[model samples]
Target: MSDGVATVHLVRSPARTVWTAIALSGAFLLAGCGSQADLAKVNHPRTVVPAKVVQKPQPNTPPRPVEPVFAPERLRAVDPCALMDTQTLSAFGVPASSRAVALSDCGNYMKDGAGKRLSITLRLGQNVLISDTAKTTKLAGLTTVESTSTTTCFVKSVVQEGSVVLGIVAQVDYEGDSCDVGRRLNESAINRIRTNAPLRPQGNKGSLTSVDPCAIFSPVTATEVLGGTPSMTPYDLYRCNWRRDSLSFGIEFAENTDPKNSSANKKAEVVTIEGVTAYQRKDDSFGNSCKIEWLHKATTDGKGEVATVSVDNTKKGVDIDLCAKATTVAKALVPKLPKP
Candidate 1:
């Protein structure tokens, strides 16, 4: 751990030189004691020798502190749908529907004069990705990257950069030149985020926007289901995942239609956990995984906000019942959620 060097200086023959000086002084004294004539014959001259200076070792320098990244709590508080308001949507075309897909993503769907579908999406606090072919620019004083495909164009402004990068993105899907719309929307979003990004509805006590998904279950519960201590990873405040060996578990909160009416879950088994109706889906398309979802509350747009518990057992030849394990986690999760 020592990152410094100590310097030492040594004079050659210093002990011998000191002894020779002492012997010469003693001989002069003895000769002086014998007679005054001898004292006069002995002549001694003073000589000065300079000592080498040794520098003290310096202490190790402390490591530099890491600079804090940009994390806007206000961005998390604002509703995703609020970014694409009536005026903003009308600028492009007549708006058909606007809805939140996730906690931080929203879509404003419109129709072109030829009846082709056009859409604008605003995404906040999202994971950043830039490809080699992507073009770079600046928006609202932040570094922005723009990527285009055959049908879609995306412009994202970097909000934080380091081990993990996060950004705010504006996406446009159109057959024509989509980057123009994307750039315009990105600028508008960045300005709104700076000055006046509309916030979520106030005083909704049952909302899960402020909850941390990783804190929902106890350690004992995690260990029991994962078969050991698991690594907990949070994709965001509303979603968390766990993994230990071949066993994996996850919990998520999102905006979705009701479980009973959702097309994706039409074949899902209807069940009840913690006295609330829930739908269970067993998917073997990739591995043995079971997902249980239940409605937490209804939003103002008639769509239900829901929570999910997913358990996957990928170990070969293991006789674990995935659905039962998913149910157990859901049972513990239901009581922790805020009641509507």
Candidate 2:
């Protein structure tokens, strides 16, 4: 100690200065053992810490893809009606006659003596993913749902392993339980699958799945038949209506029923359209003035593809007015049909 004024000291070391500069640069930082720091003396020391190393992050993995439910090759030739056994259909009041709509779908009208009825339509493989809400069922290792909206109800079963979806659509107009009807339809179809029913009976070539009735004619020919570019409403793969102004007509392919047996009620005559024999029948049953049926594909009992051309000439008698136009349309359509 000196006087009350105080004392001053200054010291500079090359080693200390170089070390301080290195520490400030911070090229490497780590924890180390240290004691104290004396500012007045040359005993200042720095605190040290362990080296902190950081690593760059990696990207996350992608999710696995969903497996497909079915194989295209195995199902390409399947007939929708083949899925339902005849016994099952008869149990549900399905007549020997089931209405075909396209290749893999058909309906049996549960009709009363009167014209009123509910329809149970069976479809194969049209829908893959169906969400179940109000009703669901498990049958034959498949998930089924009974989904209804006001007028119609559908019960669908998903066979995931086989990648096949069997659907049963029914109207609520029938007696007894609606779901029961749908379940019956689905169970019958599933049972047929278990037994491995043939895609089609032997010697049966299959349906005319390739026919587009509305597009069978040229624009010029259609204009002549329809009187203009016909407003077309297609009802699946088998039927379509072409309408223009006061004239309306439809083209349809009927399977399993021969027009020969069906022509009893109507005045019928065999007419030639494009060299193929077709029956021309006049009946107002469906407001169809003229109906001309020709063969398309075949089944049995003279049963096969019965293509029909129907025209609406409500006021005109069936003589030449409706029949002439009907014949014209039929002739144009015959050449475009897929081979039986």
Candidate 3:
């Protein structure tokens, strides 16, 4: 038989080549365990996984309102004057010897226009009097005076008027005194000579009106209460009067230099009277000077209770004295006013 069919075909071809080499060694051990499980997931060890949460967007915002410290006519011209002299010594009437009574004005020889002519003399000693004119009061323009001396009675009055150019003489020295102490020192020197009167002409039709009762108490204006710079031509200072027990005020008259230019312009004339308002100021820093200021307020029966007085002109040289710095500028304007 041809070698028995070639030994069966070489034993089935060596069992089919050992079953194809065990199926190619189980497919190369399943492809090397699938590449070592992808190389253990590419060399493992990573784990961390917690990041994913975002939310942002916010911005916008707006809200703010609120609004008196003095001016009611300066609290109605406050001039309490120690409560008006303790209510005018408990209602009307004073001067029981008038023990130490004082009320003054003249603020050191007025000055504002430079007309310079001031002489205020009042002596009660050797009895020398002069001043009553219009031919000694025949009554034409009225310059009355009476008292031809009984024991020591002399009376004189000469007023040049406006800004005041006064000369008053009053004497009563009956050697034994007492006509109520010569009428309480002639009613305290005629109430300090009517607080330096002068400034009438209102209805007299002479045409001099004037106003400035401290600007009716304080709020000033009228050229800051007429301080300076008006050589005339209607500059008009101030004047006032209500009347009853008599009241008159005036200002505007300052000028008198050459004491070497008033001592090289250290000039002085500063008056600041509060209450009834009186402030006349002029300064040269204190060299050659002449100043005056007077301030007064009164009440006896006008309503009863109120009195204040102030006068100045530094040492009475240029001629206005009754100072205490006008009661220290009227107690510093009664605490800057504004309180009844």
Give me the candidate number with maximum lDDT.
Answer: 1
- lDDT tens digits, residue span 45-71, model 3: 222222111000111210000000001
Q: Give the per-residue Cα lDDT of candidate 2 at 232.
A: 56
Weakest 10 consecutive residues of candidate 2 by summed lDDT: 18-27
Name the top TM-score candidate: 1
State which candidate, 1 or 3, has the greater lDDT: 1
TM-score of candidate 2 to 2 decimals = 0.49
lDDT of 2 by residue, 254-333 (tens): 45467666645256898878888778877655343677786666666667767878777433344447788888888778
Let me know the TM-score candidate 1 reaches against the reference structure. 0.70
How much is the lDDT of residue 252 in candidate 3?
A: 22
RMSD values for the candidates in order, in angstroms, are 30.7, 34.2, 54.9
Clashes of each: 0, 8, 19
The lDDT-based order of candidates, best leading, equals 1, 2, 3
Cα lDDT for residue 286, model 3?
A: 26
Give the per-residue lDDT digits (tens) of candidate 1, residues 107-132.
Answer: 77786556777877766655454543
Please give the ranking of all candidate structures by TM-score, highest first, separated by commas: 1, 2, 3
